[model samples]
Target chain A: MAEKKVIHFKIKRQNGPTGAPYWEEFKMDYAPNHNVVSALMYLREHPVNVDGKKIEPVVWDSNCMEEVCGACSMIINDVPRQACAALIDDLEQPIVLEPLTKFPLIRDLMVDRQKMFDALLKIKAWVPMDGSWDIHRHAPLIAAGEQSVRYLFSRCMTCGCCMEACPQFHQDSAFIGPAPLGQVKMHNSHPTGKYANEDRLHAIMGDGGLTDCGNAQNCVKVCPKDIPLTDAIAQLGRQTTMQWLRDMFVK
Target chain B: MADAAVDPNALGERYHFLIRRLHSLSGIVPVGVFLCVHMSVNASVLAGPARFQFAVDQIHKLANLGILKPVEVLFIFLPIAFHAYVGAWIWLTGKPEIMRYPHLDNIRYAVQRWTGIIAIVFILAHLWHVHWIIPGGTEFDAHAAAESAVNAMASLWVGPVYALGVLCAVFHFANGIWTFLITWGVTIGPGSQRRSGWVCGIIGVVLALMGLAALAKFKSMDVSALQHPPVTATGKVEPGAQTTGH
Candidate 1:
């Protein structure tokens, strides 16, 4: 008789936000095409440990089951990435899953990415112009070259992967992190978005603003969408300097 | 829309922008610029004890203008002290993820932080040994400079440690210049940054080489001749007060 093939997972489990975290090992029958989310789903169905004891099903957040949703971002094998995109075959066993340390943990592998969104809100990461407004017809033509950079910045899924990787983005710190900074670059580049550029820049200029970024360059490396975070930061640095000079003269 | 409430303690936002700017400005203007000058002066050891002493005397001569004290205190000491304290706070709060993430930038980031720390320790130790903790109760003046130079080379471990310190400090400054430019908005794109990186790299190598060359020169000096103080204008052996310590 052939022995049963199995996949192993070492998940850092927490009952709630304030609960102490502990690790639990789980075993599942080997199945083809099993990504991390699907493997977790298998664990959800069985709700048993490798020791043959029925246990609570593992908990994680996922919506798209694709990489786009950004809800399944966690530390898979000590690397913060999307669980939906991590295949079991590609990962070395036993796979380790933990929530991002930069954010408030909800439970198990899920974390609250609200701060990331809050940072976006603080930076006002949006074009001020209405979607229904067609002012581009009267304005000078925006070259495809300009749109290309904006397009790259628009791919951010707010996954918190960059935030997790950022050395400056800890829970106790005030750094706005790379995600919001990248959005500032994106929106500020837009034709109409430039109107409120100073406002956005001012928001980032304050407490957790641009100076807080240590230029670790970690944000660019971990970005799944290949956003040019460092470039945005560099550009913002120049804008802020100009703003400072302007302010200095005004004062 | 949620109101953008400004945090009172946010230094960058408030009148503290000057402080924040001073932090970055100090690193380059006084600290970074002074490192280059200090290394070049130290490199005079390549021409032997006489030339090295001469180089030291030249800097001391700045006192003739009655501005050297103020200049050193303001440009050299105060700026460095400010840069170090502010930097220590940032480094303490940072979370290095190179071990787990293993990305190139993350590795660089981690290295930068670690190097900054190492450089700070080395600088303090170097200052203490050279400036404050003079053996034999000798004031570290120009006459003692060459002997102290030889003293630092007397131990086998001292040379390598000195080299490592120079390497770390030079790297921190060089890599810092690159970051400083980006942070200040001078380098806006990949091309500019890449060019600036190459420039900083070249500067680092040159500075490191100059530092190591000085140490190597010190190692090769004739200790017998180094022990004797140089003659003054009156042809008498000048008493202690010449050499700058580690």
Candidate 2:
């Protein structure tokens, strides 16, 4: 018989958020079209180690299985990216999987992305369109030029890749990271969203806000959505400066 | 919604905006502007002892007019203190993962922080060495200036160290001008940022060249010719002021 083609994975396993982490190796029968998530699923069924011994199934998070929902994000071969999009064949042997170091790890490859969501909340990363009923005939028109830029930012999936690569967005740091800043730029461009612009700007102007961005710009490089995060940072920098001036002179 | 996101009147909230903006403002005005001016002032050495001492006399004359003291404190000293204190705090808190992110921008980020550290130390040491450390070796006295300059070249590797420090300081100031513009939102889009990068790059190169040229001028001077003191504004060296250290 021809030698059986195999795929190897070296997953960093943990029992809990505070659990001690250790690497466990497993090999699965090679199959075409297997992504990291599906490979983990195959291993989930087998639960067998490389030593031919029964073990616990590997744990990870996934929703869309496509790249859109970013729950399957993890460190694959030292790069933080979406596991669902990381095709096993394209990756090197014994593909390494670990939780993103910048976040609070849950178990295996899962990490709590609450900090990113909290940042979004802090920045009021929304259009205040849901308040008291004042129904209008038409939605506010946004310029095509502005929409193209806003469209780029609107693709953020709340994945931690940007934060993972950010030098200022670690667990102990107060910097809100770049993801929220992208949302800030996106929402602020909306004709309705601009009403709360100063409020959004005010939220980011504080300690953990926009100024905390170190301009390392790894966030832009690592963003899965290809968001123009640094541009948003620069835009926010400008907005806040204007706000600062306005605060000094007008209000 | 969510109670207006963040509190507007909190201690940190109220001041962080102003403080951060001021931080960038100080970098441009007092800090960046001062670096350029200091380099120009130091470049006077290229004109030889007479012109260099003339420049020194003009600066000291500002003290006689009582303008230099206040200007130094407000523009130079105080801004430096604030910029350094705040800058050090920011630098310390950063989570440096330089090895992973090897992008040019990321490296520039780390370089900026490091150059700030080098610049602060260099400025302090340079100030003390020229202004306060050596007796009668004030930069005003051309002979003492020459003695100290040669001593710096030979003693404990001051010349190379000073040169490195000045280079780092120049890098910090020049690179800082780019960040300053961004932080202030002066460069909004990629086009503007690219243009700003070129502008700041030219500024940095010019500043570094001016500083190095001044150092080169110091190294080129004939040590024996600077043995005698030049006549000053009062036509007298201050009492207890020896012309040379040894």
Candidate 3:
């Protein structure tokens, strides 16, 4: 008879927002084709520790159990990504999971990712439109290259991987992180969004805006979506320069 | 939103747009440009003291050797003061998490800030010894400068200090340039950045080598006949070679 293979799991757990964090380990009979999401589900059902003590079920956030929803993001083996994508077979032994350190902790592996969303507000990541619209003959002609670029930026799910990996971004730091910067480029290049171009540029021109980026280039590397965040930063850098010129001459 | 953007009484936020850009611009124009020229001029030491002193005299005649000169005051001193001020604020606040990320650029992110700190210290010390902490005349002759520079480099620690200082300054300038492009939006994409990276790398290596060579030659020179200079607004251009390198 073959020995029963067991999967070892070490998880960082917190009870509530004000709960003290502590470590809990669990062992499960080896299950084939289990990603982190499924494995976590199994653990939550069992809720038993390695020491044979009954414990509270491990809690996390997830939606669209594929990688698209950007939820189920946690530090697995020190890398932040969607838990649904972290396959058990590929991950190293004793898979460790922790909450992202860059945001406010809500539970064991969930966080208040509201900061990233708030950053979206800062960049005004939407096109302006009035209710009373006159009919136009055609839609705006976007170049194929520009469409491809915008598609890449549009795929950003606000996963907080970029934030988790960014040195300049954390709970306290004012750097608006790379996700919003990419959105700014996307929206600013947008024909309809171009009306708010100067407004968007002015928003980021302040203290915690573009200049705060230390240019670690880590945000691009750690982005699971592979968005060109640094490009956005550089583009905004140029846009703001133009804005400065306009402020000097036109304004 | 437009009305809310610019507040007259908002502390610090009001000029952040101009101040931040100025910080990036200041690092490049006068300060980064000066490091390049200074390194090359100092490297003339390899051609022997006569050539080295002539390079020094050319600069002294034009820019002068004084704690307070118009060209030096406006261009060199003011820019450096502002850069250091803003740079210090940036360095103190920005924390580097290289352990978690550990990417090459992440490591460089830390190195850039560090070299800034080192370069500033080195600049002040170097200026104190040779360039401008004390009052000196505009017409500091070739022999006098060669003598002063030789004796300055005569110390046991000066060579190593200069070697470290030169490398740090060059790295700071080159890296500053890379970020400056991104900061000012010159190289927007990764392909553009990679190409600029190659150019900046070459500039850094060449500048660093020039600075190191200058240090090596200056340290190996004969400083036995270090003499006081003759004070005059109209000093002789040539007064025989005062020193030679090993």
What TM-score do all the candidates reach, one by one? 0.89, 0.91, 0.92
Better-scoring candidate (lDDT), 2 or 3: 3
lDDT of 1 by residue, A1-251 (tens): 89988899999999999999999999888998999999999899999987889988888999998788889999988788999999999999999999888999888988899998988888778877566857556754568998898889888999999999898899989888999999998888888888788778778777667888877788887888899999999999988888788767975
Point out where model 2 deviates above 4 Å. Answer: A1-3, A130-136, B1-5, B133-156, B227-246
Would you list the C-alpha lDDT of every candidate in the order shown?
0.82, 0.81, 0.84
- Give lDDT: candidate 2, residue B53: 57
Off by over 4 Å in 1: A130-141, B1-3, B7-12, B15-17, B132-138, B143-148, B151-157, B226-246
Model 3: per-residue lDDT, tens digit, B1-246? 553534535756678778888999999999889888888888876766656666766676664445337877788889999999999988876778888888989999999989999988988777765664443412233456666676677778788888888899999999889889989999999999989988999999999999888887767767765443332334332454233426
Sort by lDDT, best first.
Answer: 3, 1, 2
TM-score, cand. 2: 0.91
Local lDDT at B19 for model 2:
81
lDDT of 1 by residue, B130-240 (tens): 664324332456555677668656777768788999998998898888888888999988799889999999999999999999988777766765544464654333556
Rank candidates by TM-score, best first.
Answer: 3, 2, 1
The TM-score obtained for chain B of candidate 2 when compared with the true chain B: 0.82
State each candidate's clash count: 12, 1, 0
iRMS value of model 1? 2.9
